[model samples]
Target: MIKQVRVVLFLVMLFTSIVLLSSQTSAAAGAISWTKPVERETKQAIKGGTHKKQEFAFGDGDLYWIHQVTAGQNQQPYVVTIPVKGESATFRYRAVAANKQPYWAQVSLRDVRVLPAASGFLETENKSVWLGKPIVYAALGKGTIDEKLTLAPPVEVKKTAGGYVLQVRLPMRAGLISEMWALESAEPLVIWGKESLEQIWLTLDVTDQAKWLYDGYYYKSPSTYVPYTETSYWRIPENYVLRSFLYTGGSKAALDMGYVMLKASLKQQEQQGYWKSLPRSQWLQNDYGISEGFYDTRFNTGAAGMMLKGCALYQEGEFCDAAKRYTLFFQQHAVSNHYVVEGTRPGWLVADYATVGKKSNTHVSLNHQLAEINYLYSSYLQFGDPTDKDLADIMLGGIVNLGSRWIVSSGDLHYAYFPNGTFGRTDYPYLTYNDLVETQRLYKLLHGMEEPTIGKLMASKLAWMEKNKVAYLTIK
Candidate 1:
């Protein structure tokens, strides 16, 4: 009986050992080996002494070893290596700024075949280049890069003798945020039985906020909202950011950030119930030849509308109160102060921008009118205020009366109506369409009937977009 028991115990122990060995082998096969440069290699590769290494995990279990080099009196370059194991590998890259100041970086990846080169134009004044894979090698061997390279915002690539060189630039005070920009390669870049490397010039723009967002760095206590000290763009909570958080059913972190931003906006409200113009906003407006003085009507309307949205979505009394203040200012002050202009027709037009104690700008932008109409109508629905509906109706009537006059020769709408009775410039192709759709929905909700003019306008814009094969156009 004792010998039989020992045999059973021995069999169980042997089976457990085999299972453990198999599991260990499997894990070793799946693991990735990341290599960093030694001190001698680092000194030879980078010109600056501010080189630092850190690790980050972005999505799921993917890990990256980030090596940073700060640019001093001269631009600095640091080499990077990405090892491809299977058929391919993909990675993301971006250049950040410390403040709103502009920055630039140059990246050169060697001995690898990059797939799906960056394409399309951004809203800025940068040109694009176009080069096929074969053309890239031929041109590079000839010692001349082509001018027609595809233009991708934040990054543009040109072919090099060994591989590719990418030029990246950040616009000054543009307040632009981007989605993850990815680079994928077709195969591993092997150099003499080793992995080929890439070189990039990284600037010292990494902040606590950036590290927290990208690298999961823990802070003792983080701010509810991103502060201006982190990035200049967050000096004031942007209306679009607030709307995104509340409308999209965002995560808890996003909601907390949005709530704090809403409170900050309320605190910044003037005695007259409007916020002052942000210099960053003025810079963008200046690009479009739109001069905003003490305050902008369009910006205020959007801001107040977003606040009201937050009130209804979150059931927050503070947001409701702030929105009501703006509503009262609009009804009592804007209406009597000539900010609301009466057109030749029975409709009314809201000024695009204004200065304190003076008449507003004469040019009436279609987007501004539509946005105000949408806001006022939404206000009416939320607060049961007849004045809001009345104002919205008149402003909407102006759009209907203008009709084809607003439509350019290309079936697109003119950006704005000048005081000289002429429409000029190009508006964002889809912004007016979205505004019209919302206005039509509200009109039907209020009157129990569809607005035919708005429907026709929407159809016209859609047809033009389909004809031109335009998915999006970045006007700003």
Candidate 2:
């Protein structure tokens, strides 16, 4: 009898410890839990459609809603929410209209404020709400102002249980609704508790780079459906894969995708072996690609660096040939003081940016120059070529010569580099997150290459990004 009693006691104690440990872990992680999904019908009835529309809202600090207009149809909109601990809540939605005609939907969030301007009232002006200052009420689609999806006021907010329901109406043009109803909205709202960010990040599967790349918006369009970044930003396809690679902290799969994208980009290379800034297919499809004109130094050097990183990561000889070819092409084009120019002409693909803009003129971009040096150094690391290293050093000097032109306010890098000569007012700027990540990446490659000055600058940038809570784990 005593033996049986002892066994029961031991079992009870073990179970109690397990339960306590589990709860402790949960508390330590600061996990966020989803509320039971609440289904709410649209504010008004559909005028002529046979289908009744309903919106299902889920709360994880911020509200996420799925508008089901055609419940029976399989081609419903896809809204993916990536909640980071700080910064904005990234909501990527794709709304496909069933009609073939020009279809349009508008998304609005009413009665919201950025700061407290009035005690209990939201000030409105010309369809925009004023918190401390006036902001447009809608989260516009990633399109030009005159485009069907890109309206000035798209977001409208209404009072909810605790906060507000940000309603975004997406309007897609007729017949093109199915193709055009895709956008990522980074709505700004404050959610309490650290778990809000932790839960979302923890739920992210580390191996799923495609999903991360799609959600992260590190790369612009055509590479992914909805962008994490702005739509107008033309980036090398390899940059997205590089983002996924760094986000995963050198995951083998991301490295593989980087190889795949670079190889695919190589196919887009013109007869002269230099890639056009946008792929031929993308140019044929989108107006923005055509408007940007062709070729930029960022695209070529960035792509070459991506290929070299792949060669180093995978140890494949296939990438080595392409890397060498690209390096040689860059060497042949050294126009002024080993600096490559911005735009290119048709036949010889000569540098010429004036055709694109009235004021735009040919010049070296500091970012692109650094990007080439990054590639050259990587090639040196992979092939042990002294010449590549020498070129990298030479290019570094050119970049340093332009350092006084950096947008330094109060003795800090303002993150914009002159794309037009050093005298121009319009320097191509980067997103806060991208700037930090790029610097972090530069630091990673240059730390052991006798480039302490650049490393220190990168370190400062990284610190600033982290202090602002804008440094995501990938950059860290």
Best by TM-score: 1
For model 1, the local distance difference test gives 0.46
Model 2 lowest lDDT segment of ten = 126-135
Which residue runs of candidate 1 sit more than 4 Å off their true CA positions? Answer: 1-237, 278-293, 332-345, 472-476
What does candidate 2's lDDT look like per residue over 146-228, in tens digits?
Answer: 11223212334344443344433323222222111111112323121454332222222211111111111112234322222
10 residues in a row with least lDDT, candidate 1: 134-143
TM-score (all chains, Cα) for each model: 0.50, 0.41
Give the poorly placed runs of model 2, Cα more than 4 Å off. 1-236, 242-262, 279-293, 336-361, 402-407, 414-476
* Tens digits of per-residue lDDT for model 1, 382-456: 899898998788778777777777777788777787665678867664556666666777798899998887887
What lDDT score belongs to each candidate, Candidate 1 first? 0.46, 0.35
